[model samples]
Target: MLIYLSIISIASILCLWSEKSYKKGELFLSGFSTFLSVMVLSVFSGLRNLSVGIDITTYGKNIFETVSTFGPSVAIDYYSRWADTGYVLFNYIVSFFTGNIHIFLGVSTFVVELSFLLFFKRYRAVLDPTLSFFIFNVVTLAYSFSILRQILSMAIIIWVYYLLTKGKYLSAILLAVGSVLIHKSAVFIILIIFTCYIITKFKEKINQRYLLLLMILFTLLSTIILTRYPETIDNLIDDLNISSIQLNNFGSPMRFILFLFPVLLIKILIKEKFIQNNEEYFLYLISLITMSFGWLGGINYSLTRLTYFIIPIYILFISKKLKIINKKSINLIIIFWFFFIFWWLIGRGSEGGVIPYIPFWKEYIVF
Candidate 1:
């Protein structure tokens, strides 16, 4: 774990320094540095033990083996018994090349990270790429070590969101549909995009305070509904065709804080006139809505997974907002943020099966 932190910290520094070169039009230097950072992350994550993510041994490996041995039609039919179409198809394509699970994992890691880096380069104007990348590594990247398909869906949704922001509505919608095929959770992305569109169209008539209050009310209502009618939630999950294997009865209070703090911070920044962007505001609202739903339906693990869809947008908003603050204040903020991330990585992160890091090579040797 220490090694992971050390490497990520170094990468963050290099990325921060390279931002200067990016501003000076030194495209090759900036691109090379970003590529190196992403490569380190991809290689490390791809090569980790199947045990590292709890699901890899129980679910991922089995799925890959099924695909390799049975071929796409059989594999897809088997997985479609429980999982979504996109994930099963993904496995089928990868499995065609190699029966080795490690190769599948390696390919997945490279594809996901490369897609993210390409998107980041195109949309870095929305946020400081360095800070956005750093926050992603610390707060959300490890979670991908567990839920690979969902993370891939998230990457696709992010790209779709970028397209929507650029007025490429047709492309965004098409891509969003493709994302939903990957993971049912991505349906929330489509829902939220339409929600944001309506809100923006009525920005003049709508009261922000009323909107916040409505969100709180909606959250409470959803909680009541979830508690009193769990079957309804179950039916909804079934309707979406999502896996219901990992349902939990308790909410993650600590994770709730982790998701909520940046949200409130962004609100504060907006109120102080330090930041003003409709797209950021839209993302903030979506994060609040989804996270509130997660808290409300805390017993339903799939609802929490929905929160991952919008987290990238929140990271971008926070990163951009941080750039507008005074350097001294930003420094203090960075200190606190780093401490929180480090503490999470050492504590809860490990508890969640993301630590005691073992590379694929090491695990292979031990076996």
Candidate 2:
């Protein structure tokens, strides 16, 4: 617990420093702080004991060992049976240099954090990247610690968004495909990207209120269908040959509340006219879509994970708009998030299997 809290505390200070530097137009100082913040987290994540995340012991080390023992081609061929080809290839490529699992973990986390930093920088005009990074650590990074492949896929998808925003469509398209190759679940996010494109293309005709209502209605209807015929979802997954995925009857009420809070916050931003242009409105819509996925967690608990892809989006959205909110309100919001993150980090570390944090050095007795 000391290790975990100390890491977050130090990173949080750097995040604050970064935000202050940016506000003062000290670009170099801000960038340095931002880089340091990310590196601090990335290094900690990379150097954690192999037993830290459940998946590390269950699959990560196995795949790393396979590549080290039998070479890349055989390891790739063997794991490709059930694992993602891109992920296997990634492991093999990383294994090619050194078989140290710690190196692989560090490198993978650096990629994820770098992609996220780029995404935040792309929207820096509308967001405080430092604040967004802090929220990401509290809300999403723990899960990333465990779900390595999907998190890599998530990073690639986020990079795709960054590329698209920069008008680099060819690169974006290639990376979009790459994300799916890394994890099939990325197909949902690809659909989201396509839907967002359609929404943006027709922004003049799209009614944000009506679209939001429709999304809420759809979520409610999905919940009913899931409750009435749970087997329908099961059968669909089975037919898709993804029986590896499991289903749950209902999601946690705490999660429902957490997801709903963001929707309400977005509505407040819209009501206050904080969303001034089509681009901002489009961001609002994407935030709505992201939160709605969490609402539909009633359909399958796993559906909640779909929201992970948009963590950067909604965080950027809120950070951008919250500037208009009163300082007291902002403080309240921060307090809410602090409590939520505390509960999540302390109460449910087991969920991500990232608790009882152990540094790799200690685990290996190298110190």
Candidate 3:
């Protein structure tokens, strides 16, 4: 944990010392630096040595069997593998050379981080790289898991952004299709990217307020039909069974913050005349609406899965806003993040510990 603090302090200092170089439009350099930061964190996941047996799958093994057919790709349970087809391939290909698991895990982790650099370069001057590094390291990227396919699918999506940057729509489609092959979860995001593309033409026809209203109406209607329309809702939930799983503890508080922070940050970007890019602003607006869906009247707490949709846009939106934030504000945000990370990390440790301690902060209990 101390190492985490060390990295943050070093990265923040580097960010401050040469702020002008970044402002001079050092797109490749900044993107590469952010990617490097993520790569470093990925390489060290082993040192973290954390494990959770949440994901697992299985099938009939060699009970005098010869030459297994269909492999774990088909045999493994969906939840155990994060339902990622890519993860299955990663472990499968590596199994052929040597049954050692760590080799594939390590390679996959390294590749994920490396591809992020490519993604960053594509986003380029459109984002603030320093802030990108800060979030990747401080957030959940360091946590390694057995769910390799989901991880690899995420890596592929990173590269997809580059394809969009180059206007290689065909290549983007191919990559997203490939991601779906590796993990079906990518299917939903593929649809999102497509929807976002269609909405881009509306840059001339529609405005943000109009977009926000449509988003709100869509979300409310979706929630109502899902909640009030019993037969349809049951059919869909029964098929997906996703909500039945333990909700991702994005620290529910973190969920609220990730949702609201974009509105605040984007407001700053708008004030600075920085958000005119059509595609970028559309993504930002979508994120704001996705989170705001949490507030709709009839929606139960199932919108948790929507985070997967919101995060990338938030990253883009916040990164753009960071460039306009004064150094003092960035420093303050960083400080708060450090203390937040520290408090969160130690609390997690205590929860995982054999005997949870009663910390002394609650002094009034004694009083």
Candidate 3 structure quality by residue, lDDT tens digits, 198-252: 6764456556677678767776676677567745533322233333222333343
Compared with the true structure, the alpha-carbon lDDT of candidate 1 equals 0.66
**Cα RMSDs, all models:** 4.1, 4.3, 7.8
Per-model TM-score on C-alpha atoms: 0.84, 0.83, 0.67
Model 3 lDDT on a 0 to 1 scale: 0.49
Ranking of all candidate structures by their TM-score, best first: 1, 2, 3
Off by over 4 Å in 1: 81-83, 234-253, 274-277, 326-328, 331-335, 338-346, 349-352, 363-367
Candidate 3: segments with Cα more than 4 A from true spot: 1-39, 47-50, 56-84, 96-98, 142-147, 225-254, 268-274, 289-306, 325-328, 334-367
Clashing pairs in 1: none
**Please, what is the whole-model Cα lDDT of each candidate in the order they appear?**
0.66, 0.69, 0.49
Show the colliding residue pairs in model 2: none
Better of 1 and 3 by lDDT: 1
Best by TM-score: 1
Model 2: per-residue lDDT, tens digit, 294-367? 66653464564567777667776777766556355664676467457545533353445566777876874421
